[model samples]
Target chain A: MIRTFYGTDTLNSPAAFFIALTIGFFFGLTLERAGFGSSRRLAGIFYFKDMAVLKVMFTALLTAMIGLSFCIGLGVIDPSTEIYFMKTYYGAYIIAGLIFGVGFVMSGWCPGTATVGMASGKLDAVVFLAGSVLGSIFFNELFSIVKPLVTWGQSTQQNMGQEGLAFVYNSLGMSKSAFGFLFTLIAVVCFWGSEYIEQQHSDEIGKTGYFNTPFLRAFSLILMVSAGGLFVLDGSVNAEKHKAVSSSYGLHMSEKALLRDVASAVDHVEPEELADYLSNQDPAVIAVDVRPAKEFNAFHIRGAFNAELPDLPQFVQHHTDKRMIVLYSNGMTHPAQARDSLARMGFRNVYLLTNGLGGFIERCLKPVSLRKEPMPENSIRQINLWRAYFYSFDNARPSVIGSNPSADSAKFSDMPPFLPGFVDADWLAVLMEKPGLKMIDFRDQPEYNTNHISGSYAMSIENFRGVLDGVPSMLMPANVIAARLSLMGIEPVFRFSQKRR
Target chain B: MSSGNQKPYSNPYLAGVFLGVVLLASFLLLGAGLGASSGIARLGAFLSGLILPTHTFSSEYFGAWGEKPLHYYLVFMLLGVFLGGLFSAILSRRVQKSVVEKGNAISSKIRLIYALTGGILVGFASRLAGGCTSGQALTGGALLLTGSLIFLICVFAGGYAAAYFVRRQWHD
Candidate 1:
C-alpha cells in the first residue's frame, strides 16, 4: 500500500507543516494571478459588471471534482478510509452562508482575497484583516450563547447515524461517476452563460467573437469525455469493490434450524472434550481464539489461531466441513455470540468453547485434588494432560491462580500467581541468574539480531506452524515441535515456543 | 486610472484549473482540503493568548487547541499565503498603497470602516460555519460535500441580495 499520512498523527509533524505552507503558497499565487487581489474586481461580480469569480470558482470546482473521481476510480485513494468527510450540519451551514454572502458583498473581499489585497498594500484590506481578528475574538467571547445555533442540526445527524461523507451524489442516491459527469456538463453550461453575460456587458470589440475560441470548445469536450470514462470505469469495477468493502454478513440459515441447534445443545463443546482433542493434537479439530490481540498474546490456548469476529466468516469458508472449528474468548458470551451467528450463516461444524477459556482453565487444567468433587479417572487424566501441555508445568503450579481453586490451602500459597505458560519481565529478570533457563526469542531474525536477551535461541514462529487442510498456521503436531526444539539443543519446554514479541 | 506598467490578469479558466490541481494535490498528500478562516482565527486566538493567557487558554473556543495556538497547519498556511500574495503582487507591479472603493465617491476613511465591518461579519460567520470561502466553498464544494454545496449557493444568493443595499458604496 502506498502509505500517505492518513490514519496517523503525523499531521503536526514539521514535514506536514511545510507541505501545507507550499500548498498555501500556490493557492495564494493562483488567487492573486486571477485578479482576486483587487476588491473592486471582486465586487464587480455582484454588480454584474464582471463574472471572473463565478467562472473561476466553478471551473476550479469541476476540475478538482473530476480529478477526485478519477483518483477514486483508479484506486489511488480509498475515499471511505482516506478522506475526512465533513459532517452535514444543514441549518448552521446555510445560515452561515447567507451571513457570509452579505459580508462578502459589503467587504468586497473574502478572507483569502483580503490577504492578497493586504499584500498589494491596500490600507482598507489591512483594516478588514484587523476587523476579522476582532470578529473572531467576539465570537469566542459569546460562543456559549451561539453554540446552539452553530451546532443546529448536530443532534438529528447523530440520531440518524449518517456518519459517511454526505456527498451531494450520495445524498441524491446517484453514483459518484454519474454525479461527476452531470456536474461537468453543468459547469460547461455555466461557463458558456458567464461568457455570454460578460460579452453582453463588454464593448463592441470585446463582444465581437466571445464564443469563437476553438481551444475552449476543445477543452470542454475533453472534460466531458473524461467524466464519461470515469462513470463507466466506476460502474464496472468500483461498484463490486464497494460491495465487497461493505460485508455481506446477513444470515443464510433458516430461523427454525438455528433455534433447533440452540435447543439441542450441539452448538458447544465441553471443556474436558476440547482438552482431550487439543492434548492429542487432533488434526480434525481447529481452535480459533476470538479475543483481542492483547489478551490473546498475554495467554491463549495453545495451537489456536487468533482471529476477529468480522474475519471469522472468510476464515471459516476456507476450511472443509469435516474439521471441527471451535471459537473461544475469555468468557462464554463472545464465543456463544460467534457460534449463533456462524450457525445462522449455515456453517455446520462451528462450535463454541463451553463457558469459554475460563471453563477450560477451571475444569480441564485445574489440579485433580483442587476440585470440589472427586473427578472420574478419564477426566483426571485429561485434566493432567491439558495442564502439562498448556501450562508447561508438570502439575507443579496452579495454572490460573486468580480463579481461586477450591481449597485455597497454604499448600498452593507459595506458588507464584504468574501464568504458568508465560513469564513476565520480573520473572525473566529473576530467572536470568539461573543456569537452567532456556529463553527462545520468537520474533523475526532482524529484530533478534538488533537486540535480544543474552543466551536466548532465536527461532521464527513460522517454523512451528504448517498448512493443514489448506489453512495456514494450524500448529504442526506436538512431536514435530518437540523435534524442532531438541534440534536447537534445548529440552522441550512448550512455553519456549510461545510468541515473545 | 491604468498604471500602463502592470500586466493583465491571467485567464480565469486557466487560473481556476491551476487552483483545482493545487486542491487535488492537497487531498492526495494531506487527505484534507484548503482553508483561510481557520488560520486567521488561530491567529486571533494566539494574539488573545498573548494579552490574557489564562482566559485564552481556558475559554471553550480557543482552549481546545491548548497553549501555542499558532503552532498549527493553518497558521503556517496563512503565513505562506501572505508571502505568496506579496511575491505575486510585487512581480505583477500591482502593489499600491491606497484604499479600494468607488472612484472619487466614498472617502478612504469611510471605505476603510465599511471594509472593517464587512471583515468582522465574515470572520464571525466563517467561525460559526466552521469554514470560509476557501475551506468550505472551494475545498468542500470540489469534494461535493452536501453542506458545502448548500453553503456555496447561499453565499451567492445572499451576496446578490445584500449587494442592492451596499450598491452605493461600490457604484459611482
Candidate 2:
C-alpha cells in the first residue's frame, strides 16, 4: 500500500522534507505557467482582458478537492489520517484577504509568481519580489504592534488537535461526502460563471489583440502541468505520511476529542489543586493577566504576569512547560475568549479564571475596598479607549524587545537606509505637493479616526477594498481620491499614502 | 516577424483541464493543498533572518520559518515552478526579454512605481489575511470556505471597481 503523508504526522519524518520540496516546486511552476509572473497579465483579469486565470484556478481547485473527498469516501484515503481543515478565523482572513487581493491586483504578481517571473527575466517581477521580501521583513520588525491581530487570526482547531472541518461537518450533521458534493457543486458553478463572464467580455479582450499569443499559450500549458503535478505530489506524500504515522500509533480519537479532553482537563483542575500547583515550585503555575494594559496596571492579581490575551499563545509557546496558565480578564467574556483563542492555537494547560478578574479579586485577592461606583458613560468610554491604546502599546513592546537589537539600533541611526517601503516623511511631503494628489488611510476605523494625517480620507482598513469598487489603481485609485479631494474642495499635485505603505 | 515570433496561448478549457489534473495530483500525492503566500512568507522569514537574525528568530510569526533553512518545500516548489515555466516558454519559443507594459500612454516608470507599491501592499495584506489570492481563493475556495468565497467575491468586486479609474493606464 502506498502510504499517505499527512501534515500532522509528517513532522518528524525525513520523507516530509522531500515531499514538501516536490509540492513547493510544482506550486511555483504552476504559478509561472499561469502568467502570474507578469503583472500586466495578472492585472488583466480585473480589466476583463483575460479570465483564464480564474477559470484555470477554480477548475484545478474543484478537481483536487473533489478527488480528495472521493478518496476519503472510498476509504482509499482516511480523512482522519490527514490533518483536517482549519476553522475560519473570520476577522483575520477577511481583513487580510482584502489587503492581499488589492496587493495582488496592484503588484501584478504575487510573491511566488514574482519569483518565477524573476527567473523568467521580468524586471518588474524582481522589483515586486524585493518589495514583498522587504514588506515581510517590515512586518516582522513591527510584529509587536501587529501581534494581537496576527495571533487572533491564527487561532484555530489545528493548533489544539481538536479543530478540524470534519468535526464541524459532523456537528452540522452532514456527512463528509455530502459536504464534498456541495463544495464541488459550488466550485463548478463558479467555474462556469467565470467562463460565462469571460465569454461575454471576449470580444472586448480580443480587440486589444493580446489574447492569442503563442507565448501565453505555452505559459498556460506549463502552468497547468505544474499545478497538476503539485496537487498529485502533495496529496500522495501527505497521504503516505498519514499512513505511516497512523500505523505507528494506531487509530486515535479525532483531533476534536483530544482538544476537548485538554480543555476539560484544564477546567477540571480544582481551585485548591491550582493554588497548590501555584504554591509548589516544580509545577510553576503562572497567573496570566490578559486584560488591557491600563486595566492590568490599575489592579491585577499580585503575582499575575500581564500577557495580553491575544498574545498568550505566543508567550506560552515561547515559555513552554508551564503547569497551569490561569488567564484573567476584566469581565466574564475576556477569560473565555482568551481561553478559547489560546486553546485553538494548540496551547495546553490554559485555564480561564472563572468569573474572570472580578472573580479573582473577590475570591483570591479579597480587596479591602469593594467600591462599586459606576462612572458616567462618557468617562467609561474614555477609560476603555485609554485601556485599548495602552494594551496595544504594551502588547507591542515585547516584539520590539524580541526583534534584533541591530534593527532597532538602526532605527535610531542617522544614516539613510534604502528600505523598500520606508518612504521618508520629507519625500512624502514632496509627493503631497504634486497636483491632483489624494490620500486614503487604510488603517482600522478607530486608528484612522484617531490621528490620521491631515487631508487624508478615512477609509477603514477592514473595508479598504470596498473604496476601490469602480475606482482605478488597486492601491488607491487616483481618480477616486481626486474626486474625494475635489469634493473636499482641495486639489493637490500628488497622491501620497493613498493606501498603507 | 510578428507571425513567426508569436506563440498562441493554449485553449482556456484545455488549460483549465490540465490545471485541474495538477490540482488532483497534488491532492493524491501530497495530501495537502497548494499555497503561495506561505512560500513567500517563508522567503520573507529567511530574508529577515539574513538582515536581522536575532529579530527574525524572536518573532512569533517569522520565527516559525527560522526553525529550518531558507530553502524549504515552498522555496523548492517555487524554484520548480520557474524551471517548469521556463521549460514551457522555451518549448514554445516564447522566451524573450521584454517589458510587458500598458500602452505608450503610460510610461514604464509609472507602471514600475505602481507595481512596486502594489507589491508592498499585497505582501503586507497576505500576512494579514494569513494567505494570498492562490491560497485563499483557489485552495480554500475549492474547499468551500465561506470566508474564501466572500474574499473571492470582494477581490473581483475590488478589481472591477478599480478597473475603470485606472483605465487611462491600461486602456488609453
Candidate 3:
C-alpha cells in the first residue's frame, strides 16, 4: 500500500524538498498563467466585472475533487487514515475567513499570489509580502490571547466522539462518492451562476463567452460523468482491499517452530505482570480479549478490544515487534490458540495471558482476605491495588467466595444481575439503542405514558417492595431482584440506570 | 511602462485545470497540498533567528520550527514559486517593475499602505485559521471539508461586503 509520506524519513530527505519545489513551480506558473499575478484581475470578482477568481478557484477545486474522488473509488487512496484531514474548529476558522476576506480585497493578493506578484516586479506586492510576514510575527506575539479561539469548537467535536479531524461526509453519514457527486453538481451550478454574473457586468469576460466554448462544455461534461462514476464504486471494496493488503504479511514462522515456542512457554505473560503493564498505561502493550463478543462486552479487562481467533491477524496487523500484544480469554486455551495463529501470521511479540482472565480475577481482583495461606506484604498491597483498579463497582462483590470464578463459570448467576449506577440522559439516550439493554422505568404508568424513554418497561419500585416482616414498603430480598433480572436476560454485566435529573 | 511585448494571459479554465493537475501531483507525491504562508512564516523565523537567536527560538509560533526554520518543504516550495513566477513573467514580457494598484486616482504610496495593511490582516487571519487560501480554501475545499467550504463562502462574502468600503481606493 502506498502510505502517506507523513512520519516517514523520505519526507525529510533533499529529494523530497526538490519534489516540493517542482510542484510549487507549476503552482506558481499556473497562477501567473491565470492572471493571478495581477491585483486588478483578482479584485475584479468583488466589483462584479470579472469573475475569473470564482471561475478559476471553483474549476480548480472541482478538478482536484474529481481526481481525488476517483482515486478513492479506485481503492488507491484511503482518505480516513492516509490523508491528513484538517481538524474542524468552526468558531476560529469562520472568524479567520471573515478577516481573511476583508484583508484579501484590501491587498488584492493572498499568500500564494503575493509571491507571484512580487516575482512579476510588482513593488506593492513586495510591501504586502513584508506586511504579511510582520502579521505572522504579530500573531505569534498574541498567540496566548488567540489560543482560546483556536481551541473553541474542538472540545465539542471531541465530546461527540470525533477524533479531532472529521470529514464532511463522515459527519453527515453520507458516502464519500455520493458527497463528491453532489459537490460537483454544486460547482457546475456555481460556474454557470458566475458566468451569468460576469455576462451581466458586460466586460471582456462577458464578451469572450468562455462558457459557450466547446472545450469547457466537454470539460464540464467529462467532470460530471467522472464524478457520477464514483457512485458505482462502493466503499466496501476499499475495505476488502485493505484486508487483502494486510494479509500479504503471511505466516513468518514454521508450524513446528511456533509449536516449539508455545511448548517452551516463551509466549506466555503472567496475569500479574500484565496487571503491572496496565497500571502504567504502557504504549507498547496492547491487551486483546479473545472472547465471544457477548462475554467481552459484559466484562473484559480495561483497554482490551474483543476479537475472535480469525480477527486476530487484522486486529494486531499494525503492531510491529516493538508492541507487546497480550491476548486473553477465560483460560489459557483460547489465547494460546490465538498466539499460535498470530505467530503464524508473522507477529513475534504476541503473548498469551497466563491463566487468562481467571488468573487475573483469582490473583489480582479477588480480595486478599479469602486466601488459604497468609500473603506477603508486597503481594497483599499489589492485590489490593489491582482490586481497586479492575473491580471498582461500588456494590458488586470483588469476588464470590467459594464459587470458583463465578462470573465466568456461572455467568454471574450467583451474584446480583445488575449494578445500580447513575447514567446521564445523554448516556441513556445512546444506551437505549444498544441490543439486550433492558430499561425498567421506576416511574408510574401515567408519567411513563406521558413521556418515557422509548422501549422502557414501566415498573414502580413499590412493585418490588411489600409489607415484609411487619415493615411497610420494605424492599424485596436481593435474590428476588437477581432472579427477576436473570429472567429478563439482564446479566450481572448489566448496569441498572438511575437517570440524573 | 510598456505593454507592447506582453502576451495575453491563458484561458482561466485551462489555467485552472493545469493548477488542479499540479495540486493532484502534490497530493500523490507529498501526501499534502501546496501552501505559501507557512513557507513565508518560516523564512521570517529563520531571518529573525539570525539577529535574535534566543527570542526567535522561544517564540510560540516560529520557535516550533527550530533554529533552521528554512529546512522545510514549504520553504523550498515558496522559493520555487518565486522562481517559477519570475520565469513566467519574463517569458510573457509582463515583468514591468511597477506598483500594482487600482488606478491613477490613488497615489502609489497610499496604495502600498493599503497593500501592507491588507497583507498584515491576511497573514494574521490565515495563521489563525490554520491555513491560507491555498491550504484551506483550495486544498481543504477539494477534500470537501465542511470547515474549509464554510471558510471559502465567508471569505467571498466578506470580500464583497468590504469592497464597498475600499471602493474609493480602486474607483477609476
User: Which predicted model would earn the best lDDT?
Assistant: 1
Q: What is candidate 3's fraction of native contacts?
A: 0.75
Q: What lDDT tens digits, residue by residue, belong to model 2 across residues A86-122?
A: 4465565666666666666766677666766776667
Q: Order the candidates by TM-score, highest first — what do you get?
A: 1, 3, 2
- Kindly indicate the candidate among 1 and 2 with the higher TM-score: 1
**Which docking category, incorrect, acceptable, medium or high, applies to candidate 1?**
acceptable
Model 3 residue B163 lDDT score: 95
Candidate 1 segments exceeding 4 Å error:
A155-164, A203-212, A238-289, A292-501
The runs of at least 3 residues in candidate 2 whose Cα sits more than 4 Å from the true structure, single-residue gaps closed, are A1-3, A11-14, A28-35, A151-161, A164-196, A203-501, B1-6, B67-71
- lDDT of each residue in A118-186, candidate 1, tens digit only: 888887788888888888999989877887777565422221123424678877778777788898898
Order the numbered candidates by DockQ, best leading: 1, 3, 2
Cα lDDT of model 2 by residue, B79-154, tens digit: 5566766766565554557555555677878777767876787777667666666666666665555556656676
Query: Model 3 chain A, poorest ten-residue lDDT window?
Result: A154-163
Lowest summed lDDT over 10 consecutive residues: which window, candidate 2 chain A?
A: A367-376
lDDT string for model 1 (B8-125, tens) is: 7888888999999998888887778888899999989999989998777767677766577888887777777888898998899888877464546677777777888989989999
Docking class of 2: acceptable
Best by the TM-score measure: 1
